[model samples]
Target: MARVDRGAADVITSDGHHLAQYAAPLRRATVDDPVALPCVGDWAALTRLPEGRYELDAILPRRTAFVRGGVGRDSRGGLSGDSRGQVLAANVDVVFVAEPALHGSDFADLGRVERLLALAWESGARPVVLITKSDLVGEHLAGLLDDVAAAAPGVDLHAVCSVTGEGVEVVRNHLGGSRTAVILGASGAGKSTLVNALAGEEVMETQQVRASDGRGRHTTVHRELIPLSGGGLVIDTPGIRRVGLYEMSRGVDLVFADIEELAEECRFSDCAHESEPGCAVLEALESGELPERRLESWRKLQREAAWMARRTDARLQSEETRKWKVIHKSMRGRGRP
Candidate 1:
């Protein structure tokens, strides 16, 4: 076990190799205790224990953070949700949006791919598209790569097969020491298989896809940060079925940059780009320069982001009002008047 000096916890290994270090000296509340907290890809100052043990003391500053909203139950016990930002990973350089091969000669789900790309861009990390399971169905790799390139302009796309070990080196070449990357996709996308192949061992568990439907069950339950033997680190996350847009306005703008750039020529400064005369975005769509699907995706994400912001703002306002009421009650009791 290699003990890393992260400053706080002593690293100990039962198998004589360092895999994981204890997070904190004592169990503490996640909400109340803030310093000893740990997030994926965080470099911590740890304390080395006797016999090669380590514990985390403090988390160093992060270069980037990928956050998502936490879901909670509502008052009626159905699904009341508030936006609690949970950091998924930090300091990630690249985010791999892996997708499975489409079945029955149908092309892959481009819209889902675009959503993941938007989230990746919003994560403050460079996005890379990975189309997995190339070995199955004899799908041409170039066509998938081309589709991805068209869907996500200015992003790297790779066609990789974990089972055949094809196109894996290209992914490894980009990773090195201190570089972190995250793998994201739905269940049965072969993310765990890809992770195992990249690690050169069975570090993650993989499940076989159903023969009839071509869908697989979720195998990974928790998110983990694992160091690769080749040098860099990788964060493997649970299969995400849906990823909602959360305050990702800049990312949506970046995704539809062509439309945004053309909108400057609109007659009104706040043109909706819908039925507005002299709207350059609409003109481009009419001229066949811009795909209607791309514009629709942009509009959908923009509206979703705006709705998320409104919900978050409403929650904050409620909290603020409650705080003021408490303060007023305290002042009334003090009799300062």
Candidate 2:
């Protein structure tokens, strides 16, 4: 499927030659799990309804899926009570984490990049960090790149200027060979502009950011998969203001692999790394080997991932309990009859 809205979807034929817009509706079973519904990049089986409409019968097992917790927004601009995982894209091969090279006094939001990278790693896709608007930073570009690179170790990092076409080719190279990549970033990070650059045409609309605070208007409201002229596919999503983790302990560990490695040398197996004697992580922090900011970011993500895991477990247990209750109720009603 190239796009999904409500219960309908725009599906691309298996041969990749035809696109049927809003032609596929969800099968009853497919509606049980919201995250399992058709999403951009998902390969689905379609059934023809008697009413002459195509229904999304089933989705093929996804090689990778980009999911986040808390689908709705709360009053404080955080995730709402809805704890179900929301799948952004399915079967994605590359996750491009974009951030503006110049954001007020900061070159890029390293924390956001780290968070997105964790999600990308958890999605079973290769995560690449793209520092957009490199042209604006001038001589500071190298330093900015280094800072962001520090945040994303063992991940491909590129400082790209979509307007100037600088560093865009290298980023596009990963999308070759019929691979699918998804652009994830805050609004005004030049995701759409980057997509246009990679596509060699204005496939997506672009909007300028506000001058006062560098925030951008939401130009891409829906997630749509666009085929690149050079080959491969890209899913452009709306600017995400807040992205909550969804049962991502492995992802968090991968993101903080350096800390994980350091912790192995701790004297105790479960050292908290907080003033614990012989704690290599704390030692690295004190010795300037690990930045304090990075350590704090890792800790925050770990806590959040743990909390989300607990919530997911509770939700699943509750659902199972409800299922049994319904079954027992049905049996009781049958006996009475």
Top-scoring candidate (TM-score): 2
Q: Given candidate 2, what's the lDDT at residue 187? A: 93
Question: Per-residue lDDT of 176-248 in model 1, one digit per residue for the tens?
Answer: 6667898999899998899898899999998999888888789987677777998887878888875766567
Candidate 2 local lDDT, 22-118, one digit each (tens):
3324445555577876789999777666775666667889999999876677789985646578899999999999998774567788899999999
Give candidate 2 regions above 4 Å deviation: 14-27, 30-32, 49-53, 73-81
Candidate 2: how large is its RMSD?
Answer: 2.5
- In order, what lDDT does every prediction score? 0.75, 0.87
The deviation in Å at residue 248 for candidate 2 is 0.9
lDDT of 2 at 1: 83
What ranges in model 1 sit over 4 Å off? 1-37, 45-58, 137-140
